[model samples]
Target: MKDSFCVTVTGQSLIKNDVRQIQHKRFLEVLDFLRQGNVVFTNFESTILGRYGGWPTKGRYFDYSRPEMLDALQTMGFNALALANNHAFDLGPAGVLSTLGEVWSRGFLHAGIGTDATDAMKPGRQRHGGHDVSLFAMDAGPGPGNMYAEDRSNGRPPRPGVNQLKTVRKLGVTKESFRTLAMLAQELRTSSLELTNYAQPDDPTAVIGENELNFYGTVFKQGSAFRRHVEIDPENAGEHLAAMQRAAARGDFVLAYLHHHHWEPGWQEVPGWVQGFARACIDAGASVFVSHGAPVLQAVELYKDAPIFYGLGNFLFHVPAEETEWSAREVWRSLVAACRYNGSGQLESIDLLPIVIGGEEETAANRLVPLAATGEVARNILQGFAKRSSIFGTEIAISGASARVSLAAARKVG
Candidate 1:
């Protein structure tokens, strides 16, 4: 006989209220499906209060929710959580400590935020269906202070924060654009002509060339225009890869997740580095690569037969009343990814459950809850997924309210 396992991964959850009152028929069906999986994972997108600390006072703005809601989450069948989002440190280290204790006390497994760099970067381990499963999470979004866990430094202690994939950004532009900027700067400096149309760089120093300009180590190749790009820091990304590799070497199935909001021009399209990083994670033995924080549905790809969800959108988002964006149709729609693994630890298939947030009436009285999409809504959601996934040559077939992708059709590499 062969052994198998199943896991369902959802997106960011801003659970501000208890979920015990959920009694709708369609919504209950989705919850029951979630309970059928061996592991249910979600990204906790709010800070758990250690004390009576109210909402954010000075730092970055984020919703503050009571930690008691953990009970509701567990009751809803979420046994695992990723805590590397922007709100993880909204209340500082005490909040993280409280959350760590609460999650552990409730017998829930979580990773990506902790007392220090090591604690935050360590994988959360669980045994399911005669196999060890490890979950490693990180945040690739940009932020300052407490956003990234710090290691011990020269006479400085390690600071508590979230596991981070720090990235280096570079602005790329063509030589023609560089020359135009240089000429403008020269005119601005030589002549006291103050122009508002042409924005000035922080530094007035300009290095212009006929072929190419190397201005203060910022390279400008022969191109058309300017665009910003990012590369994951080698040391930071290497540490995460090593962790996943170690977990796989120990015979534990590894699920590596990241929270990132950096997208391409469109909300659904991701940058090239995201694709590269997902593929590299699979190469390092990750069974799946899950990404969120965009709060919008993105494309899904099969890299090396492992599922890569660029964005899962919101699963349970009930923010403050001022969060008007939640009313948008896109933010209220997402998919629940159910991944099946075979006896040999190879992916067998993927089932996508189309879900719509908000109630059927779409009124203010409707609270935040994910209901199963039916009829036209179901077809549209699945169609959008198929269209986006087509770019990766992955086809999704819709049946009822669910879409599926069998591993047999997934692209394989030599």
Candidate 2:
């Protein structure tokens, strides 16, 4: 292993265009910055199309990329990819196999989707710059159950799909509201047996402590106020953490990545459970933790000498012309994080380079390319980032068009 190493992490890439054709100066500069890291990581948000042949699965929007799209990502110097996002199953099992085949052919270190549950849960390991790097990736979804990978059992064949970190949504309601729901269930003659049969295999309808009820498939808990909670399944979480521990025990640099769509009501707010989970991963021996789902930057934390990025937003978000939701500035603003570790595998510092997708002049031709942010735009982005990081007691120092997290200072206060 090398005495020191650097790893670069960026937001999800939902690219569909041949961005390598772009030669904008700022965009090229971003590419150069990414190449500086021994391992450049990004989530490949779109599944490959046509090569292996498949039909579109149901989704609010279907994202399919051509084979050459991988070339564009490689051109940007991304050698590590997470393939377990919601869109991984957009074209069914064949699409998963196609994507896996294409990514493998390109010699990229990738994880997440696989031919079965065991395969999906396994980490992707590679040796880069004299460092053994291991990546464990999964998706926490409020998505269709069938989209997740399943192992073969009872004479059935295994399913090819994304690695899943199962989570359940619990609705917290007032005592009165719970009573009303129970009464309505009785009035409608809702059958518990039928509800259980229709529920996902891992989530069954049940009652708890006389104050909680699983009506239909939703679990409602009696509480002081109405709220929503996302609970990670311990068994699923344990499996992923165990994988990280095993990798770290082997003296590998472990990277844990999670993709989820369970955003807080305030899109930019980091969920408490996610914070707990990321910390748990570090405790389990992850060298770094990163998550993406909310299409906006959230927060960054330096915990126990490891960096945790709650959300990294979008890097290359290409959507249909009709998709105007992405036009919002927040969706286009993000930063590329370069983390440097010392000889003993302790974090030394982090350089945050603020970037804006499509640059100042966003047009059809350059809409999905990311460019370096400068002047007022850069300061504003870094300021907002600093404010968000402050929530976790992470102090970021802004300088010129970029920001940095120094390990010595972070340790002094952490």
Candidate 3:
């Protein structure tokens, strides 16, 4: 094993246009720092295509980048990109294929989508500093069945799509809550058939799949009250676990990443099932488990000597350029996680670098640039990290300009 090596991770990056004009000093400094890492990772949040060639889909916004835009990411030093988010199918199968072609042609390692289910499940491997690091990407975004690739089951050919993990939504509540739901259902005159299986909408194009929203869920008894929970499909989890194990067997280091958009009632907190899912990944042989989605930073948890970043926020926020879907400012706050491991394969350091997103308006020369947060902005970003990670007992202390997370303390139970 190498004495030490760093792995840098970032959240969503959508380069709607070109990135050649960006020249922010601090931002470039951060990019240089990422370039120094053994493996630089980020979520390829948007597709790369010259024009839309796929069937029309249902989404408020669809994002596609020019081929030249890839030069910017390559210049920024992104070695691997995860492509299993909600927008993977924004432009449909043709878009997904185009995105894959662009990334591969650029010679960057990528995971999360493939020509078939087996191919999608395969991990992306890269050698850095003499250490073989493998990356496995999966997404659990809420969508129709077609969002994910399918195996050649029932004598059918394999399908082209993204790697997906299924989520089982359950309603866990007290007796009173169940009674209230029952009363509400009665008021709506909802029949049992409607509750169990929803009727397909008259317009087939209206729904991405058979259904999108799940109002009813299977009930379970937890002591005196009911427990509602959205758990990962055990079979799907097993498949991912097997993939992680296979990667571990072939590589010196393995990292499993997830693009999960599911959040708790309060958007700030991560769903309970995700926490378990992280641990399961670790148990399955992943040295690190990173997650991004929600386009906002969330909590950080260290479980069983492995680190789990629930959400990394947005590293490069340039999407929704045409139609307004999300608050621009809220999506701008972002960070870069630098993880270092010793020769013994133990995590030795984890640093959080805060950044503020800038657009062409801020800098007449650039479209979307992420500058290192400083002064009040730095403090505020670090404070936000502290607040979000505090729930997991991970503390972030201001260390010069960027904040440092004490992984030694994080080694304790979380």
Candidate 4:
């Protein structure tokens, strides 16, 4: 076995064009940095609109990328990709097939989307650095029911879509507030039966619980205090966890990736449920756990010698010029983490390089390119990242333009 295996992880990539022609000095430096990893990984966040043929599923703000974008990512030195995200189905089922075709044709180690639920849940495996590496990707979604892959049964055909880690959102309210809402529902005659009649077959109305009321599809429960809760479906989580265990039993290094839109009141705040789930992944033998959905850097935690990156923000956020909604500077700032593991498959250290998409220019021409952050910008990025990681009891040592997680200290405490 090789003395060490290095895996580089980055934030989601939403590229819509071929960017191989750009020769920006800083962009090239970022590319050079990416090439150092034995297995460079990223979440390919767009659906391909090519040979398989697809139509825009959304009325507006939907995205599709040309096949050449994969080539651009390959040129950027990404060998492994996670193909599960909110935008994975922008062009519908055909888009899923299109993305699978293009990615597979390039022989990239990719996972997360497939022709059926069973296929989608399978891990993507490869051999790198004389070690077997497995990656499993999933999306915890509040998306349409048809956006998730379904197994064929009876005489029906299987649906092609992304792997889904199903989650339920429950609005918890005080008993008094719950009674008021229940009365409103009763007065409006929006009972479960009434809503069921209007609901689509694929997305049925939620069943009312003994202490809960189903307002349309949202479930509200009486509780001690008013709060919003997102719970992972046990069945879905079990399936993914079993797969990770199987991969680990085979002695393959496992990387678990999750994409979700369940943001807390503060975008950068890490949800408690997510923190628990990430720890569960580490327990299930994941060498690293990464997630992206909220477009801002979140906390980093080291658990049982594994690194959990709650959010890495965005690496290549290529939205339409008119999409001013993503104008925030934090959306363009991110980190490139290189996790090194010894030959024994134990994580040794992690090097974090702060980067800013489009550098300091923030112009249309430099939009899709990532540049190494420098000077005060680099310090500010590291400072903010250190503060977030500190919340998890993880120490980040910043030196000059880069930072590193203190794995020795983390391991000692673990």
After superposing candidate 3 on the true structure, give the runs of residues whose Cα lies further than 4 Å from its correct spot. 50-52, 171-228, 321-325, 359-367, 412-414
lDDT of 4 at 167: 88
* 309-337 per-residue lDDT for model 4 (tens digits): 99999999898888878888888888899
- Superposed Cα deviation of residue 247, candidate 2 (Å): 0.6
Model 3 score (lDDT): 0.74
Q: Estimate the TM-score of every prediction.
A: 0.87, 0.96, 0.85, 0.96
| Candidate 1 residue 400 C-alpha distance from true site, Å | 2.3
Best by TM-score: 4
In candidate 4, stretches whose alpha carbon ends up further than 4 angstroms from where it belongs are 190-193, 205-208
Question: lDDT for each of the candidates?
Answer: 0.79, 0.90, 0.74, 0.89
Ranking of all predicted structures according to lDDT, beginning with the best and ending with the worst: 2, 4, 1, 3
Which residue window of length 10 is worst by lDDT in model 1?
196-205
Clashing pairs for predicted structure model 1, backbone only: none
Error of 4 at 1 (Å): 4.5
Error of 2 at 115 (Å): 0.4
Better of 3 and 4 by lDDT: 4
**In terms of lDDT, which candidate is strongest?**
2
Instruction: Tell me each candidate's RMSD, in Å, in order.
Output: 4.8, 1.9, 5.0, 1.7
lDDT, residue 404, model 3: 76
